[model samples]
Target: MQSTRQNSQQMDESDFYTNCRAVYLTMFKSSLENITSKEQLCTVLQQAGRNPSQKTLNKYWGPKTSKLNFDDFCEILRKEKPTGRSELMQAFREIDVNGDGFITHSELYKVLTSKGERMTREEVKAIISVADTNSDGKLDYKEFCKLFMSTTEVCQKRALERMEADNKMRRQQFGSHSEGFSKSSLSHTANPSLGTNQQAEMDVTPRKGEGKSSMRPSSARSRRASVSSTISMGASGGSKTGKLLMPKSVQDWHHTALKGCFFLEEDGEISSHQYRLDVPQTSTVFLTIKPMNLSQVEEKPSSWMSVDAMFFIVKDHEDLDDMRVVCFTELREKEKFGWKGELSSGVYYILPFTTGCRLKKKKKNIKEQAQLVCRGEGGKLALTKEFRAALSDIFEVIDLDGNGLLSLEEYNFFEQRTSGEKCDEEAWAVCKENFDTKKNELTRQGFMDLNLMEAIDRNGDPCDLWVTLESMGFNRALEMVEACPFILDAHSEECKLRLKAVNLKQSSKVLDTAICKSVMAKGEAKVMKGSESVTIYTYKNDFRITSVIANKSNQKVTIHVNSEQSKNCLSSRGISMFAVEVPPRSNVVCQHVLPINERQEWIYNCTESLVA
Candidate 1:
């Protein structure tokens, strides 16, 4: 969205190169120092299978253009190709600020400001402080080059020099100590006569009148003991690995309060560091504690429960005991009561206090919600896209007039179409029969509302002869029917459904033996009868089927069709079921309601004989 501007508008080439060099040398000191020649560095990169550009190599070499001594080295580096003139000019401008063949901090700040970098006065002062080589409040060209380059080089040089000096000192000390020991050993070995005289003299004791000898072994032992004590103290003291070692005073304090012996007087300041409390069920209580930070609670101190309780901080907030205290435990012990329906995540257990306070806790160690649902009784079926498509096909079948949407009548037609079927069909019919009968035809949106509503009005009367799209002064009911398919398709598979079917008692009856087949795909089902003028029925039920019927010639297929409805009975017309080949292993079943007045013998005869 934003265009990148020129080098000067951002960072001048020279300044950028200097900064890159500084960072590179500071981070990769040995590599930068050892690889003196540009060609050698390029050779190294080539050996490593790298091909860094010349510009990148020059940038890592620091701002050498301003330093006359490095000019030849820079030229040698660029022998492969001539460097860009604009970049060299920018480098020159950086060194020769004010166009007076000299550089200064004011000039640098001006250049940075011109490039849209707004460095404050203090920041400018800091930059100047770093760049001031002579410490004379300003910089000349030569001093500027030295200071800029030294930012990276000086720190490394100082550190190396210090290491060299320390090594030299160590060597000198070792040599001198070795020579002193050799001289002492040589004198003892070469003069046994003197050694015996010395031993004899040492064996002699001072006279009783003599003052206390200065070289007493007792004094030497005391001095040696003191030195050993100091070493031990120093070893155990000072910083551990550059961090102040755990202060003994603090550790002792903790040990004394937590594990150290304490005399508990009646009301003395005994460290009440650990305690447990039992809470009653459905009861509220306030706990008081000594005013201290929650972290100081020594009872199960590592549990985050203490931190969770801290959010209720007040002048006198009570400390929580260990997590062992379960509020339900007291209830179970006393009243033999326990909560039904276990707690779930995203649901919190609130423990209310008598002081108008509460604590919230997430349910711990619980099975996931999805797993819980899966383990539910009867084993819930996964509501997948295919299942939803089936429901949409059923919805579209009911929206008869080929309208783009469904009215109450169209929706009811769907319900009625499948109401008389069995299994899921029966379930759907039982659930939605009242829904369909209560309205003429539900609009697509209206059906959605009814589906989402928890309950239906029981007392309302049913509507009859609902207005079609044409009657409603809309486009043809075909558009409405078209719209119904989409809405049904959109229905989540999770939506509970029931499918039902009806059949005649006679096994050989036209509706009994003939099968109606529908093929479903892309959320819509087409019933496949050989002819375009095939007759289908829409009962008050929720069953969906789609098909593509190949013509007798098997050349073309017709997709959508509206079936006719039967009165006071379920019927499928124009049984063009020749399109379907029945599998030998297929099981066929039929269900229908028994007339209330029918004799038990008649009902038995009707179902048993036909089913058989």
Candidate 2:
């Protein structure tokens, strides 16, 4: 059920009208009397991070005319829309009264003067004049096709005229108050979405694990509202895109994010995603992080452009600095930086941070953004059996004197290389207390136990563990691994360039969206509630276990997550409390539950709302 006014008042610490106005001005920048259509309503839904199917959108949409205002946009979203097709397309089919696959002037006049704006005879004739190509004073099927699509050479001529007319009308209607961009200009073609005669820009933003920036010709992006307490970073102008050829197992998406970041204005957060790379045993992969710049895409477009971005790889809970910095380059040097040798397996994070996207914000500075791309050769994603075998081999190598027990000197030699810390007598005593030991020396099983403890401490992060394993001489036989969820820090100033995350779990319109969308492995997604105000999407991947939450409401929804069932979750080791605040009708993978072993079950509970 919807929150009552008293609940709203009690929950909201700020002014209620301000909240109302914020919701009111969600679409068209003003809700007062400004008309919107189904297409524009779809754009608004996209801005809120939803890619609902046409059928789903149609169920929620009202009116085929440009009469759906901001209030209609609000009310339609708040209500439950069942599965259905659009009545708008059906309306035209009904207009062809003779069933001859054509519409006549009499039919058009009968409908135009009766429904919607009730156009005058002159206006009806004007529409017929654009569609009737044969000069027969009647519209055939081909002529009717011209009304909806202008992709053909014959269709473009008349459609161009109609589009220019619509542009002129839009300029006159909103005038100085609007962004002043023509639909044709934004679409880069004369074939605008037909029938509604509304303006919409198709979103083509970057996505997760991406690290390149591209410039678009459209300049109708909104300006980013500057934050007074913004943290500043140095970035150069002009970035370039690079190619990534990595380990074979998980090598599906390989594009750098366009030179921009996803910035959530309300939360002051940026977009960050993870890409897993598997380094094969006994192989060294040469890789590079390529930076990109904004290409000049417009003669006099109305927005700024991104020219640079940043990309790096790290283990879970590790920062860019914590991992090795192979090669670092600024704006000018767009060349491939350095050669990559070997990376330890087990959940490495590839973070691409782009800034200064032009299409989303009207920033005049036009600062260049950074672009990052990664490429690697073929390598199998390591499994637990492979790791155990490799570790067993290492134990043999470490027991050099033929004895299976590790003495203080032998263990200290290992301790110094992986961590640079020598184990003292007290520490050795503690190790003996926790692990299998014999005659005050660590046995083979004890050594494995010691390493297992290290893995547990890092929440199963394999970077340090692999370092220890490599030092003991086993980097040649096996490589990296899977397990544990990662974090995504996405930041786009506005909706257009947000490169919004897709909830692939939703069987809706998404394939047509940008590349690099989440690749949730095939599994049954247990949805808690129906497609109502709240939804939960779970994915089961041997590499990473994650969950997505979709909020199908107008106002912000706070979700409570309880992981009482999954006792072995590394992040908590017990029940965890999480509150996630989701935007209206948004889809986001919010939970990162990391289970310890193959036997541990991953379960999570819910609570209050979560806002980010």
Candidate 3:
């Protein structure tokens, strides 16, 4: 077997700190700012893909050498005896790049991903979630320490504490002439030809794909190699170490178009949609249903089916009626209904069905449908370390509750969101039987296992896995090897409905829109206020009830949903109490209010609140 560990040439203190200086000189607002202390330099080194140990970093930028925050920083270092509170308080300030009292998720994510042992995005999110007492997505100094705690127990049992003994010992040693750790290196002869040490090589693997973030310092130099600096920490070499060390995945956006197709059984004409996927190997298949009109004959503007359609990714059979559904999309009002499941290359059918005979959706509403599209991406997300890391991020993204356990209901939401398939009672039971679970909730391991099972069932052909990781909003821009994304528009026997790409769109102010007029036309609204940022719009009718929650803020918001107000109402997930997370300025169908009996007045009085 090949060696799994990666090896790279190591750098000495001069190279390491100079590379650190390279990052500091580049990403900062001004190129002149020097790396005067460990705190400032540590964060920069993270962006540069160098994670030195405490002993190592301290050895390079020691207590005596650092000019941290002038006297304030040095006072703590000099005394080495600041109280635990003071030490942590100081640490928080250094991490706060903009000097903002709170540390934002993006900032924290950047620090964690670049500096430490590679972490799944989920791990970092969990850390802040503990200290984010206000549920505002950012951490204040106190919350930061509380989340970091293990000793004082002032906050929850998870509180972090610095030892009083350690602080006192460091303070008592403020004696002899403590010299700069870098003094020897600084005194060495200066080299004028290294040309700024800009090309220093680190182990970060660079790819042409979308990096984690797109936020680049406009003034930063282009990608170069061999980063080196003189004894003086003047950065000269340019090392563009995958510049996307920031918080966001800017490449995950979609190029969307409005697509239309007819159901298989309409007016007994037997028209259906089928696409061939003759993959030379196993692959991934995912698709989304952002919106579909329920209108027949004349397309009514702004309408969702009275009940959503059943979509399927099925084995393509010569007879449409005999097709075997590989996956199912349950009937629900989920606006972001999609799939990200693995598939072997073969012909398949993308089937959509409702109970109605013949139905027609006008082109007028097609643009609106396309504009409200669930995002589609992940053309090649193979199961590499990157894929594993991506899955960890996905797990955290779906873990609406910070409890670290994925309740069956939460897992169900994940299922429906990723594959439009609900994790029914039997499926949930099977999960508990096979994978790790806690208190009937899927642990992070189980969540991973569930996804792993999909690919594993196919004997682990990773081409499929790559496609599976490509997009969270699984929808129909699917393709095979060397295939460009296209939509097949066809007309059956005698149906007059036409299919065309009505428009091309990017973003939608979908959440900004007021109560969907179509939703109002079908049922009465049940208003549930979670926060100023999130609004849960519930609509009730005879058979079932549905709710859509929208976030108005720039931060990802989690709102707990409670159906207790409805004496006998249960959500489609079968749980009356599960939280839903709404991304910033986005809306999703959060709940499907199912009724125990069809004859009763389906009282869907659901309530919600921001998770704090």
**Which model scores highest in TM-score?**
3
Per-residue lDDT for 72 in model 1? 25
Write down the TM-score for model 3. 0.23
> What digit string (tens of lDDT, one per residue) describes model 3 on residues 1-612?
123221121223223322333333334432223356677756554444344457656754643343332112221232332136667778678889888688887887887788746667888878777777788878786666654443333321211112223222432331111222223422111111101111111111111122243232211111221111111111111212211121133133222222333321111111222233333345433344433332235745223333233344446444433445565433222332344456564555444432221122111212221111111264432234434455664565445444678876556554543344677888778879999988888888776666666665665554444444332322222211110111222211212222222211111121112112223334343322212334445454333355565444444444545454464444544444444445545555554554444334345555455432
Q: What is the TM-score of each candidate against the true structure?
A: 0.16, 0.21, 0.23
Arranged by lDDT with the best first, the candidates are 3, 2, 1
Q: Can you give the lDDT of residue 13 in candidate 1?
A: 32
State the local distance difference test value for candidate 3: 0.40
Per-residue CA lDDT of model 2 for 504-591, tens digit only, reads: 1111112101001231222233323211334454543332234555444343343434343344443311124333444444554444
For residues 400-445, write the lDDT of model 1, one tens digit per residue: 3445355443344343322323334454455455443333344444
The reply for model 2, stretches above 4 Å from the true place, is 1-276, 282-286, 291-306, 312-332, 335-342, 345-353, 356-612
Candidates 1 and 2: which is better by lDDT?
A: 2
- Which ten residues in a row are the worst by lDDT in model 2? 222-231
lDDT on C-alpha atoms for all candidate structures: 0.25, 0.38, 0.40
